[model samples]
Target chain A: MIDSRYKEMAEVGLAIRIKGLKKVYRLGQIGGTTLQEELKRRWEIWRGRDDPNTKIGQTARLTGETFMALNGINLEVRQGEALGIIGKNGAGKSTLLKILCQITAPTEGEIDINGRIASMLEVGIGFNGEMTGRENIYLSGAILGMTKAEIDRKMQDIIDFSEVEEFIDTPVKRYSSGMFVKLAFSVSAHLDSEILIMDEVLAVGDMDFQKKCLNKMREAANVQGRTVLYVSHNMNTIRRLCDRCLVLDEGKIIFDGDVDQAIALYMGIEDHLKTEYHFTEESRPYGRFSHKLSIERTVIEGVCDDPRIGQSYNNPSFGYGGYCLPKDSRQLLSNYGTIPEKIIRAVVESNDTRKKYIIDKIMRLVRMAEQAGQNSVVGIYRLSMKSGSDNSRESASLSVLRGLIDRGCTVLIYEPSLGGLCPVEGGVLVAEAEEFKSRAGIIAANRYDPCLEDVKERVFTRDFFMRD
Target chain B: MTRNTYYLDKNVHFKHISAERKWIDLRLGEVWRYRDLILLFTRRSFALTYKQTILGPIWLFLNPFLTSIMYSLVFGRIAGISTDGVPMLLFYLCSNAIWNYSSSCVTSNAHTFTSNSGLFGKVYFPRLTVPLSQVLAFVIRFSIQMSMVLVILIWYWAHGQIHPHIWALLVIPLSLVQLGLMGMGVGIIISSMTTKYRDLSILVGFGMQLWMYGTPVVYPLSQLPDGWIRSLSLLNPVTMPVELFRYAVLGTGTLQPVSLVWSWGFTLLALFLGIIVFNHVEKTFLDTV
Candidate 1:
C-alpha cells in the first residue's frame, strides 16, 4: 500500500500539469474580413468541409481546420523549477506561454495550475502614455490583478529597482524607450506571484540592469520557491538561470530535459541546415534575375562541388519571396506577438502605415468607379508571387488582399493556375479573360510583368480605362 | 487559509483552464474579486483624458452644455417643435441629463473589446473589469454635466414655470439605472460583434444618432398623438426613462403604466442577452482579432 502523506507531498510539488493540450488555428483565416467570407466559411464548416482559407498542408481533423499551434502537448512542471523553452520562429513557444497565462484559450486541452501566474509577455503590458509613472505603477499592478494594497507595499522597491526614481512623477511617454523598459520591468519583477513567466524581455537596457534582472529571476525561482518559465533566443540566459529546458518545433515538444542538452540540440539543429538550390533554366537570362540564383551560375571553377540542381518538387510547397534577405526579417515583420522589442514595434507600425497607404489607393480607384452609382469589383491579378506558380497561399500579397477584403471591397481573382475553379471555397474566380478585363475597376498585382505594362496594376488598369 | 474548504479534500485543485465553450459564464465572482482593478482603470481614464489640457473638468461640462443648447435651438426654435409645455432649454437639458448617461454607457462599453485589445492580449484578468471601468469612468463626466441640468432646473422652479414633484427624487435615479442597463446590454452585444464585423463600430455612431431621434430627446412622446407610433415609442427602452425623467423634474410629459412595463422588460432583456454574448466573446475574440 502507498503512503498517503508521500503522495500528498508529490502532488504538492507539482506546480502545473498539462495533458493533451492542443491549440488549432486556420492558417491566415483571421476573421475580421468581410461578412460574405465569414458566412461562407461558416457554411463550409457546417457542411463538414474545412475552413476555406486555411493553408493546404494543415490537417482539417476537427470540423473547421487545424494549424495546430500547440499539438497535444503534455508537460509536468514541479514547484520552483526554472524551465527554459527554446525554439525557432513560429515554433509555438509563445503560444504555449500565452495559453499558460490564460491570455488566450486553447482549442482543446486540460491545464491545471497550482498557483497564481505573473507573466511578462511584453515589458509594459498596460502602460498608458498620458499617465505619470507613479500612477502607471498602480495601473499596471492593478492590471496584473494585484490589489492596491499589494502595490503600495512594494512601491519603494519597484521605484528603486527601475533606477528612474527622479523621473517617477513624469508621464511614461516622456521617458526614453530604454527608461520605459526598465520602469516596466521593475513593476512586473515585484509581483510576488507563485509562477513567473518571462519571454525574451531581458535583451534590452544596459548590461548592469540586465544582470540585475537575471539575478532577480534566479532568486524568484531558487530562493523564493516559485516556478519560472523563460523563453528566449539567448542561450546564455537559459544556461545561467534554467535547470530544466524544453525545445519546441512547429507545435510539438521536440525535446525536454537537461538545460545544456537542449541548447546543444537547438544550436545543432540550425547548423545542420543545408544550403541547396533548384531553379528554372529560363530564369538565368543575362543575370537579370541575378539576386535570385540559378543553379549553374557559379560553382566557381573547382572552388566547390557542383550545386544541387535540376530537381523539381513532388508538389508545390512555396512560391515567390517565401523568405527574404537577412532571413527571418520578413518573418519578423509578419509575426507581432513574438517580437517584443519596442523598436520592432515602431517598424511594425510603419509597415501597417505602408499597407494602409496602399489600401487607400485601392479604395480611391474603386470609389471613383462607384461615383456614378454603380458597384464595381476590384480584381486581384494573382496571389502567387511569380505569374505561373500556384502555391503562394500565404504570400506577402495576402496581407494587402486581406486589407482590401476588410474594407468591404469586392475582390475577383484571375489566377489562371486555379483554372477558374473555386480556389477558395467561396471566392469568385473570373475564368473568362474578357469578362475579367471588363468587370475590374482596378487591378492590383504584387509584381510588375509585361502583362501589366506598369509597375502598379491599378495605374495600368487606369491607363487602360483612359484608352477605352 | 480557513477559507480553503477544499484544503483537506484530497484533490485540492486550485485552477483549471480549458476550452470553455459555454453559452453563459458571467464569472461575476471573478469580476468582484478584481473590483479594485476596475477602479484603477477608471482612475487612469480620469487622469489621462484631462491631462495636457488647460481647462480639465470644465471641458466635460462645456461639451454637453454646447450640445444640449444646440439641440434646444434646432428643435425648439428652428423646427418650431414643442417641449411638452416646459421651457425648451430646460426640457432638452433635462432629457439630455438622462439621455447622455445611458448613451455614453453604450458607446463606451461598445469599445470595450477593440480599444483594450493591447492589454487583453498580454495579461490575464476578468475582462469584464474594463467595461465596468468604462461604465464608472463616464459617471464623472456625467455628474459634472448633470449639475448643469440641476442648476437650470432650479431657475425654472423658482420662476414658477415648472412644478417639482416629490417623485423627481425617486424616478431620476431609477431612470438612470434602467438606461444604464439598456445601454450596457446593447453596447456589449455590439462589442462582441465588432471584433469580426468592424462595420458595427461605424454603424454605432450613426445608429446612436438615429436611436436618439427614436427616443423623445428633441420632442416629447406626448407630441405623437395616441397611436401605433406612440406605442412603438413606449416600447423603445429609452422613451419611458426620457418621458418619466421629464415628468419628474419639469412635471409635463406622458405617463403610462404599460410603457413603464415595456421599458423595464426591454432593459432587462438587453442586459441578459448582453452578458451571455460578452462572456462568450471574451474567450474567443482574440482568435478573430
Candidate 2:
C-alpha cells in the first residue's frame, strides 16, 4: 500500500538528468577531513593528537590517511539507454554503482536518478543460506526491494529460469555454492526494478545463464525502457551492451563520449589518457600492509635512469633495495644471462652508467647503516623494485627482512597479512600498531601511519608520497 | 501502478542517479522496505538449522529442557548458583531462552557482511534485513523454547514451585527491541570490519562462545562478583533482556535498574554507529571483499 503511494509521489514523464556525478572514497580510514590528507600530512608536523576517527575500544588504528577511489565525475543516461562504465580495478566503476544504488554516498558530487534502482553488483546477494531454494527467491526479491505480492506473482518465472525447482523446498545450505548463485541470480533478474545497475554479476552461473543475463539486460533496456549502468572488465560486454560509455582511471573520468573512445581510454590507448605513466607505485599505497615497505632509490647505473630507455632491452635489472627484484625483472635477468656479456654491458652502458651507479649508491647506504655502530635496527623500507604492481613477487623486502634477521636485530615485518611468518618456523604476528611500535627498538617503515607518532622518534621512514 | 518517478520524461534523453536521506534513515527505510525479505530470511533460517535432523523444530524445545536440567544438576545440586528461591529449572530456563535468543541474534548477525559478501557485492537491498530476519528466526526458536519453559512452569505451578504474573507479557516487545538493536548493532559493526580484515570474523565466531559464558545463561546473575565484572555484564545489552525475562517468570531477580538503562543506551549507541559505518562501507566494500 505504502509503496504505491511512494510510486505515485514520483514525478511523471521526467527523463533521467545526471549531472556533476562525483564519488570520492576515503581509502583507508572512515573520517578523513580533507581532500589532500597525504600531501598536508607531509608538510605539517603536529604530534600527539588522537586520530578522531578511532572509536573508544578500537585499538591500533591510524588517522588522517586516505585515498580517493572516485573523483568528481559527470554522466547522463536517457531512460532506456544502456551505459557502460569501463575501467581497470580501482577505477571507481563499482563505486559509481554503489553511489547510484544509494548503497554509499559521494563525498562531493550530485546525481539525479530517474526512477527506482536495483543493482546486481554480484550474484545471489541477500540470499539466506539456511533457507531452501524456494524461500531464498522470495527473500532475494524482497531484498531487491520488491513486495511479497510481486515476488509471489513472479515466483514460477524465477523457478523455471533457475531450473532449481527440483530442490526448491530443500535447504539452500545443502545446495552447492554454484546452485545457490544460479537461484539467487534468477530471482533478481525476474523481479521488477526500474533501473538495473549490474557489476560483473553475469560472470557467475553457467554459460547458459550468462547468455540469459545478456538477453535479459537487452530486453530490460529495449522493451521495458529501463535505464541501465553496467561495470565489467569484459571488453565484449562493454561493446555489446553500452550505447554510451564512461572510462575512469585513478578516480577521474578520462573519456565520456563514444563507446569506442571510452574503451580506448580504458585500455590506455588514447593519447590523451596516455600523457605520462602517471600511475607510479608512488600515487597510492597497496593493501593493508603498505606500511611495511618503502623505496629508497632507483638506479640504472652506467646508463641513464630511464625505464623507457630499458623497455626495448632483452634483459635489465633495475637496481633495487640491496635485496631482490621483481619476477619479470628476474625473468629478464635469467634470460639476459644467456645473452653475450658484451651485449649486457652495452645495454648497461647505453643508460649512461646509470645501473652501476645506482648499485654503488645503494651498497653505500647498506654499509653506512652497518657502520653507524648503534645496534640500531636498520629498517629496510620494502625493497622498492617497480611501481603500480601489488604482487611485488621478487620483493626486496623479503631479502632485507632475512638479512636483518640474520644480523640478529629483532626484525618485525608489517606487510601484507601473511598466512605464515617468513624464514622462522615459529614467529609472532605483530598486528597491533602499538605492539609493532613498542617491540621494535628502531622502526623501518616503507609507509607511515599517524598512529606511530610516539615511536616515530626512533623510526626510519622513506615515505615521500605514501603511494605503493 | 503509478507511473510517477522522481525525474522521468518521455521526451528526455537520459536519467541521473541521486540519493537523499541521511545514512541512518536510508538504512532504516531499507530495513522496512525489505520486511518481507526478513520474513523469508527468518523462515529459511529456521528450516535450514533443522534440516535432515529427525527432531527438527522439536529440538528447539528440547535444547532448553536439556539445558535447564543440566543447570539444575550443576548449579542447583552441585555448585549451588543462587536462583533467588525460584525453582532452579524455571530460573535457568527463563534466563537460558532469552540468552539463546540474544546470542543467536548476535552470532548469526555478526557475520552479516562476511557471510553474505557474495550477495552484498552483487545486489542492492537493505543489508539490515539479513540481521533482522535472523532475529525473527531466533524468535521462532524462542517460541518453541518458550513452550517448553511453559510446560515446566505448569508442572511447577501444580506443585507450587512458583507463581505467574501479568508482567510476563512484556517479554514479547522487550525481546524484539533487545534483539533488534543488539543484533543490528553488533551485526553491522562486524559486517563493516569483515569486508577488509577477516581476522575479526574468525575471532567473532569463537568470541560468541566466550561471551555466552560471561552471560548468565546456565546460572543466575547474582552468583558473579560485585565490582566491574557485574558492571561489565550490564554492558552486554543481552544482559537486561535475560534478567528481565527471569524477573517476569520467577517474579524475583537481581534485574538491576541500571541494567535496563545500560542496555537501552548501549543499544542506541551501537546501532547508530553500526548504521553509519555500514553505510560508509557498502559503497566500496565490493573492491575490498
Candidate 3:
C-alpha cells in the first residue's frame, strides 16, 4: 500500500497513485520446470510434507514457476511532472509502463489515474497496411480513445508536423520506414491527452526527429501542464527531459529523486554489479569468435552501460525462425528485389541451408536406427514459433519437420496441444510422454525439456544456447 | 512549481484498474463513449474487405445469388423437397439472405481475438467495439441483400403467384435485431473462449457449418418427419428468426407465435450471458492469447 510519506506528498495534485502494485507472470520453462512437479508440490503442501523445491522454513507457491515482474511498487506522481524510469533489461521498466498504461492488469494492486491517458508504447500502434496514411491517423486516434472532433480539429496540425503532405492519401504500406514513424509520432504528439505514457518511443527515426519529439514532449509537460511517464535506456534523454527520476532494479525501486543522482546511482549499479574478465588474444577459446566483443556488447546493450543503436544477439539454430523473423526477412528480400542487395538475400537463404543441415542429421539418425533393428520413427516435440511462447505458426522446428517428412522419413509429432490426429500429413500423432518416448527411435526437441532427461542420448537438438 | 488542487480533486474522474473481481463487467457506457471508433471500424470493414476487387460489393450479391442457385438445383430439383408454395429460386434466395446475415456476423467476429491481438495489445479501447461494429455493418449489408430479395418478391406478387402479409416489414426489422445481437454475442463469447483453447476456434469454423445444417436453411422444418429431429430443430434459436421471416414474406411456412416469443427470450438471454463472458475475457485475454 502507499506509505504515509507518499500519501502526504500526493495529497494535492496526484496524477497517479499505485499501491502494492505487483505482477507475476508464469515464467517459461528452462530445463527442469514442468506441470507434473507443480502438482506434486501442491500434493505435498496438502499433506504437510516438506516442499521439494524449497529449503526448510522457506515458502514457495504452487502452480508453475512465476516471476514477479513488478514487486510491491508504491509511487505517487504529481500532475505536470515529467518522471523518467530507468532500468536494466528485465528490470520491470516496460512492465511498470505497461501497467500504468492499462495495457495489462496488475496481479495484486489498484491504480488511480487522473485525466485521459494515452500511451506511446510503440510508434505506430495499429497503422493498417492497406489503409491510407490519412485514414490510419483517424483510426489510431480513435483507437487512442480520442473523440472525432479532437481528431478533426488536429488533423491539419498532425499532417503538417508529420511532413507527409505529399503522400498523405497513399497507403502506409507504401511509405518508407522513416516516413511511417514520422507520421506515427506526430499522431501521438498531437494528441490532447492529459497524461502520456511513453516506452522508448524516442528510439525511432533520425536524430533531428528525435530532437523534435523531445522538444514537443517538453512543451507538453511544461507549457501544457500534462503529466509524463517516460521509460528509456537513453540517460541523455532522461537528463534532458525529466525533472525527477526513478531507477528500478529486479522489480524494486532502488533510487528515486533528482535526475542527476538517480542516473549516477543507476550507472554505478550497472558498471559494478556484473563481473568482467579480460583475456589476451592467445588465451581465447575460439579463434574465429571474439571473446570480448560479445560480452562487451551484451553489457552495453543490456545494462545500458554504453547504449547505442541496433542491439541484437546471435544464436545458431536449425534456421533463424520466429513469428516475425522469417516473414520480415523474406518480405525485405522481396522489397529489395529491384535493388542489388547481398545481405538481404543471404538472410533469406541462410535459413534454408540450416534446415537442410537439420534434415541431413535426422536422415543419418534414421539410417543408424534401421541398421540397429529399430522403427526409426523420428518424433518432433513442440514447435513454438518464439521462445517462451506457445505460438507455433512459423517456427523453425515446423519447417524442419516438413523437410524431414518431404524426404520420406517417418515423422511423429508429440505436441501436447494437439491430439487424436497429427497436425501434419504423413506423421503419427503421439500425445503422451511415455508413449512418445517408447515409439520414436529418434526424438528432436526444438527446446529441451526435463522429460527428455532419460532419452537425452537419443535426442538430436540444435538449441545451442538454451536461453529463452 | 505551484500546482492546481482542482486537477486531483476527489470529485474528478479517476480510472481505477485492478484485478477485476466482478461477476459482470459489461462496460456498455464506455463502449458507447467510443461510438466514433465503432463507426470507423465499421467503415474500415466495408472499405477493406473488397478493396482491389473487380466487382467489390457486387461480390456480396454474387455470394448469396450463387449459393441460392446451387440450393435450388440440389434441394429443389434433385431432392424434390417442397418450397411450401413459394417459387424455388425466391424461397432459397429469401432464406439465404436472412440466414447469411447472421452467419456472416458470427464468422467475421469469431476470430476477433486471433486476428486483432496485435491491435488489442498496443492500444486500449472498448474491445466490444470490434465485434459490435462488424454486427452493425453486416446489418447494413443484410438490408441491401434483403432489398434485392424484395424486388424478386414484388415481381412474384405482381404476377398473382405469391401473397405477403403487411407484418413482414415489422418482422424483418425485429428479426435483424434478434439475429444481429445473437450472432455477435455468440461470436465474441467464442472469440474470448478460443483465446485459451485454440482448438475451439477450429470447432467454431465447422460448428457454424454444422449449425446451418441443423437449422432449416437448406430444408424446411415442415419437410422433416415428425420426430426428435423436428422437435430438436424447433428449440434452435435460429429456427424462429428464419421461419418467422420466411412466413412473414411467403406466408406458407410453419409459424408459431409462442415459439417466436421463446426465441426472443432465448436470444436476449444468450446475448446477456455472452456479454458477461466476453467482458470477463477481455481484461486478461492478452496473456492467454
Best by DockQ: 1
**How close is every model to the real structure, measured as TM-score?**
0.71, 0.59, 0.70
lDDT (tens digit, per residue) of candidate 2 on B1-289 = 0011222344321223343334543436446656777787777676667777998877777787888788799878898767778887788788778877777777777678767776665556666677777777777777777887887788887887776655676676675676667777887788787776666667877888888887777766787788899888877777767767776776765667777888788888888888778766766566566
lDDT of 3 by residue, A1-468 (tens): 323333453578888878888988875422123344556666887899855656455444433578999998999899999999987778998888887776667888877777678888888987887899999999888898788899999999999988889989999999987789899999999887789999878755544677789999999999999999998765667877899999999999988999988876765563321213211121143332211111000012122222211122222322322222222122121121111111110001112224566455445544543444332222222322222223332335556555655676534332212211222222332222223333222233311222333332222211101100
lDDT of 1 by residue, B241-289 (tens): 8888888888887888888898899889888899888877777678887
For model 3, give the RMSD to the true fold: 17.0
lDDT of 1 at A356: 51
Q: List the lowest-lDDT window of 10 residues for candidate 1 chain B.
A: B1-10
Best by TM-score: 1
Clash list (residue pairs), candidate 1: none
lDDT of 1 by residue, A389-463 (tens): 332322334454556666775443232222212222123321222233443233322222212222211211221
Question: How badly does each model clash, as a count of residue pairs?
Answer: 0, 43, 0
- How do these models rank on DockQ, best leading? 1, 3, 2
lDDT of 2 by residue, A1-468 (tens): 323322332444333444455654444554333324423443343455554445577542434345677766766566687888876667777777776665555656556554677778767775666667777777778777788999889899998888788999987888876677778788778856667888866655544566677888888888898878888765556677778888788778888879966755554331111111111122123342231211222211221234532232223542323322232222222221111111101000011112233333333444454354233323323333332233342233333333444444443222221212121112222222223333332223311222233332212211101101
Return whichever of 2 and 3 wins on DockQ: 3
Q: Which ten residues in a row have the lowest lDDT in candidate 2 chain B?
A: B1-10
